[model samples]
Target chain A: MSRREQAKEENRARIRASAERIIRTEGIDKLTMRRLAEDAGVSLRTPYNLFGSKTDVLIALLEGAGFDPGDALALRDEQLVMEQLFATLDHIEAFFDSDEKFYREVYGGIMSSAHPDVRSTNVERVVAMCQELMTHAAAKNELQIDTNTRELGRYLGVQLLAVLGMWGAEFLSNQESIRQVRRAWCGILLQHCSNASHRAVDAAYQSVALTGS
Target chain B: MSRREQAKEENRARIRASAERIIRTEGIDKLTMRRLAEDAGVSLRTPYNLFGSKTDVLIALLEGAGFDPGDALALRDEQLVMEQLFATLDHIEAFFDSDEKFYREVYGGIMSSAHPDVRSTNVERVVAMCQELMTHAAAKNELQIDTNTRELGRYLGVQLLAVLGMWGAEFLSNQESIRQVRRAWCGILLQHCSNASHRAVDAAYQSVALTGS
Candidate 1:
């Protein structure tokens, strides 16, 4: 890579780190472009040029904070399709629980942003991750033949977002949020699973039900 | 009722009516307490005294717009449990579609409110409505004997809210939003349904899957 490109990457990373620090020390509301630029030791327009808007910066923060689907797939390579999906939920729970205040605030910023493109961009990323997994499961004959993997992925993606929304809204705790997503996953996948994979999915459902009570 | 009590009720109705008009004609952001007072011909403190906050006013607006769970139950008394649940989703879709701009703005207002109580109050009201229906389904042996109806209800309630969240966020169109919710409902209920209800639930699942594709 060229020196200029390397410098640009370094600047991006520094800005993101600065944004995270600001969120941690202050709050999402305080992490404006001017504030971020000053904290990161860059010009005022640097943040705007690097990131389109405040919403873009928050999306970058989320992506940097392990919101990438590719990373999620790589992290659970050893598990079965159903187990892998549950693991994804576990990963999300852990991520949110790791820093509840930070995530809640960041998520609030993203969801409440006036820019619809940013919201859909984030939702589509998660949906693609789910679709990739469902497509893999379908290739292995784990899911039912009639299952529209893409649609199911979209459904799961929206469900996960909803669960996260509930958590952000303080309607569900982190643990309960994961459990709720698990229950929905198991319940939805129960009908979509092939006979060969039904047992594992059912067991997961039973576990969620048992623990929920 | 005493004359004073009756007068207070009249003020509330008038204020709510004016609030809706402002939201419908202008937008949610323009329906402040002061503006509502002028529009409703009440004292500026009248809105505050009656509604507590702008969030409370939105909640009242939502309830007035047929968001009450009791009304949902009454609207589908003749349908079976499964049908009743689906009907409730349909009811929500119609309500939102009836005036997309108005409901979307109002929903955005409520969800983004600083007060968490109003959000939970709305969520709990929907959850209770779902639980009541699920309990009735269980009593009739329509659901599996060991199914946790309450948990299932909470799952469904949260799912519905998530779907609405997607709609409010403009991630899904109105029809697509309802389809997503129905698909989740059918998938989740497929496993918990009794033998007699299995065919019906499966049919619903197939319908959602087909429509979704």
Candidate 2:
């Protein structure tokens, strides 16, 4: 990149880092433009010029922190479906678990806006990303089945996001609870897969018999 | 049923009804003690005499509207696990869908507060109710088994709450999206129960073959 472009990118990163830091120490609600500017050693108008508003700053925080799964398509690069899914979710867990206050602020900021359009569209995009991830999974043996792929994709995607939000609401110190819940989830999915293993044989037999008859 | 006691009981019901009305109309945010008095045609001190603060009014609003699941014990009494689970979640669906304004006000109020402990505790209690409901389902043979009861309960409880909050957030609103996701969940949970159901047979087989050699 050119020197000017590089400088702009560096400035942008500094702003998001400052926002994250302010939220960690002072709470998301307390992250005023003035506070962020003073902390970042920039004029007050700099934050406004860079981020437009606190909510916009949050959008940047999510993006710059590499928590935006939107950026993950680049990582897909013919990766396994289940691997991609785990990578996406693990990134979220690690990102949020990095600091309780930062996660809390981002979540609150996402939902605090007066407009439903912003929140709704953002959710829609995330859900769509999950659907795409699951589709890739089904193509491989990661989630092999005859079930409706799109339907199942939406189901798992939405369920995980909701869990993330609820878990994210708790203090980062509540990692114990998050860990407990995650272990339970893995056990349930694995056990269920084992249980359904027999069903696959039964299903194949039934399909064959019906066709044979 | 003494005259004085009867009068007190009637007045209390009247005051509670007035609080509900205010919430239904103006929402929990505006349901102040003074507003309740004016709505109920009672004295200014009547609300304070009955309930101390705005939070108390919200607690009462939740109770008066029956979003209070009573407790885990009572909610677990339904016949089928899915039926019981849906019934309990239905209470929330009804509450938030009661009035767009009421739902937003209550949720935002609880989340935005400096003191989120009480509200967070209440959410935990609600989650516990789901766990209890799942356990009861297992006890009654409504849910099948392959996994341990605790993990199954946590999985169902935690995941369902995640979906519920998203529904509350209005992120999962498309009717098609809701129905499709719910169906996949039904399939997944039924698959879970089937596994849970077969564990006993496996344990029994471990003891000995019928040859008893």
Interface RMSD of each: 3.1, 16.0
lDDT of 1 by residue, B1-213 (tens): 999989999999999999999988887779889999999999999999998999998878888877765687553445678777777777788888888878888887888778878778888888888888888888777898878888888878888887787787677788888887887777778878898678778877777773223
Model 2's chain B TM-score? Answer: 0.59
> Relative to the unseen true structure, what is the C-alpha lDDT of residue A15 in candidate 2, on a scale of 0 to 100?
80
Question: What shift in Å separates residue B32 of candidate 1 from its native position after superposition?
Answer: 2.4
What docking tier does model 1 reach?
A: acceptable
- After TM-score superposition, the amount by which residue B166's alpha carbon in candidate 2 deviates from its true location, in angstroms, is 1.8
List candidate 1 segments past 4 Å from native: A1-10, A74-79, A210-213, B1-10, B74-79, B210-213
TM-score of chain B of each: 0.89, 0.59
> What RMSD does model 1 have?
3.0
lDDT of 1 by residue, A86-167 (tens): 7777788888888887888888788878888878888898888888888888887889888888988888888888778878
lDDT of 2 by residue, A90-207 (tens): 5665777787566666866776555567777676776677667655655555554543455444555565556556655562233533443333223223322223233432332232
Looking at model 2 chain B, which ten-residue stretch has the lowest summed lDDT?
Answer: B204-213
TM-scores of all candidate predictions against the true structure: 0.88, 0.69
- Model 2 per-residue lDDT tens digits across residues B140-160: 675554435554455445554
Give stretches of model 2 more than 4 Å off.
A1-14, A41-45, A73-78, A112-115, A137-147, A171-213, B1-49, B71-83, B87-114, B141-146, B174-188, B194-213
Over the full model, what C-alpha lDDT does candidate 1 score relative to the true structure?
A: 0.81
